[model samples]
Target: MFDQSRGFRDDAVETCPVEYVVRKDGKPFAFLNATPALATRTVTGFALATPEADWTFERI
Candidate 1:
């Protein structure tokens, strides 16, 4: 994922990559690209919304 949200310079905010893995019915189902800050929240929300499935994130 390309996240243009953080950096030391305002005009040159570097993009950060985040990867998300979500499972359904005990099987991997989705791979998402998201912002680093939002990655954790996204996984948490998914786990909460879909209690039967598992979710996780990987920093790249």
Candidate 2:
């Protein structure tokens, strides 16, 4: 799955590609790619960065 979020600035946007997986026990998890697309306006100019992210869910 692909996702996008608005940056601190209205004109900036961050995008990432994710993947979901289920273990043998049926537990599910998701993670984002190492490199994500970023658009931010900095004092110097536009800059890019990579963020590490992961997600896990549990039944209540």
Report the number of the highest-lDDT candidate.
1
State the lDDT of candidate 1 residue by residue for 1-60, as single tens digits: 333565244522234445666556656767777665566677788889878765655543
lDDT string, candidate 2, 1-60, tens digits:
333453244422233333323122233432223212211122112112212323222212
- Candidate 2 off by > 4 Å: 1-18, 22-24, 32-60
C-alpha positional error of residue 31 in candidate 2 after TM-score superposition, expressed in Å: 2.7
Candidate models: Cα lDDT each: 0.61, 0.26
Worst 10 residues of 2 by lDDT: 38-47
Which of the numbered candidates is closest to the native, going by highest TM-score?
A: 1
